[model samples]
Target: MQLLLVFQGRKLRITVILGAHNVRDREQSQQRIHVRQWVIHPKYSCEGFKNDIVLLKVGINTSPPAHLPKPLNLFLVPSGAECEVAGWGRTSLTGNGSNVMREVELKVQKEKICQQLFKNYQPQSMICVGDDYRKKGVYKGDSGGPLICNQKAHGIASHVPYGYVYPEVFTRISYFKPWIREQLRKFSLQDLPGSPFSD
Candidate 1:
């Protein structure tokens, strides 16, 4: 169990390294356990910012394998896609500190709310993940967490609009699997024979 330490700000984060990130096909990469930690979601590319994006593919400094241009290949799941959202961010608006790192299930939103929220942006490239105002929304510290759908990662916790209130946002992984692989291979790979996403 080799641990890779990622330096951010004044703290160091750890990552478990295993195999060459190999897959029988590109689709396999989509099902692999999402390991994107502190990268930026390319959606903010307009600012000439790259590292600010958090991704499910690899570290914040890199991009997915060239072939996998889709930032989130698994992000846009079929209707009725059941997913889980996890984080160590915040449990409430006024929590003195982050809540215990946790995971919660959320149904992908399909209502017109999705349409209305992005009336001024590129809505097709992005997907909505939460509607439960009481629970499952990302708060102050839960950035770059994984959103798993069907036991596979679907998106990365990216951002929330209007102060983490009603609808929160996530970076779709379904659209970016191929490119993610390209960017991640340079880091390190893991060979989990019976791992959850090894199929």
Candidate 2:
């Protein structure tokens, strides 16, 4: 799978490390991946739940590793579809986060049900997934990981309740497709070499 190289935090520097396994020393394991550009959805808000997607442009032209290819989610994901959520997040509600990445299967919940569970739920931009009664889902430190359905990157882990009691929320990629396309267009106009901007 093609990896999205993101530069965040106060320093804003490029660094990479494999997600599948644990690294003993983060600084020593660093591998730099260039980022052409990135854009956070204009309507996104830290204080609110809507529009929590971000699109990144990586400077890589090589074929993806092995059988992994870039995922495309151009259509709306239907509710009840089984999706995989993977991340280096907490294994349990009160447990310490994992060093190695973990993945779990979850079913997408209906928007109506999600709205009932969360008063501020944004059906147009956000999706809710996981077991409503069972405590199985993405937890702390899982934000920003991919939610894969049918081998397509359909969602981004956005939020979960403080006590990890509620179903995990995700920013629906299909809902923000227009904005994503617009951002790619804007970035491509700059004509940067090896820019990862394509339909």
Candidate 3:
């Protein structure tokens, strides 16, 4: 059977990747769009170490979400790392910039802190951020987007409650790394079950 790759004859129309609904809503979030290609993508997270992988793939919020839990576990780019958070949701309730996108600076916060502030809502491996002053933050349309830092993805935007000054909830990434590798290996035949790391 042939899979339908897109609707309206275009992936661009259906995909959330780099699209308008993903622009963030911060005062300085404007120019940050230039970093689209600058962040690391698995192959390298930093110099010399060469394993500073950081990227994200946003998807639609499916209904009856399978076995997924309410907290909505996500990826953890890493704690205390510097990264950018992007979304296409509104800067205010009115809506984000109509013409431009949005991005904001984020400092990965301690998982414990997140849990405490969120009434123990955070889970293992979760890295939270953006509970700062009442500037714009992620909203309903922004789910499944990236919470990047140090040019790597730390988490995905999982949930944001109403009246949130800024989005504080997120999903961790590192725990999923092994699962991602296993699938890649099976698909590409890149390595045996116990192969060493490679370039």
Taking all chains together, each candidate's TM-score versus the true structure is: 0.56, 0.75, 0.51
Q: Give the TM-score of candidate 2.
A: 0.75
Regions of model 3 farther than 4 Å from truth: 1-81, 94-99, 117-120, 189-199
- RMSD values, in order shown: 11.0, 5.8, 13.2
Among all candidates shown, the one with the greatest lDDT: 2
Top TM-score model: 2
Q: Best to worst by lDDT, what's the order?
A: 2, 1, 3
Candidate 2 residues 1-199, lDDT tens each? 2444444544454433443356444554455456555677777777756778776566654335222212253335678889898888888788988887788889888787778767778876787888766557898888888888888777889988768645878887777766766776786675756656442
Question: Compared with the true structure, what per-residue lDDT tens digits does model 1 show for residues 35-142?
Answer: 444344444553312222443333333334322223533434754567777666667777743424466677677645655764432344455667765455666666
Model 2 steric clash pairs = none
- Against the unseen true structure, what C-alpha lDDT does each candidate score? 0.51, 0.71, 0.49
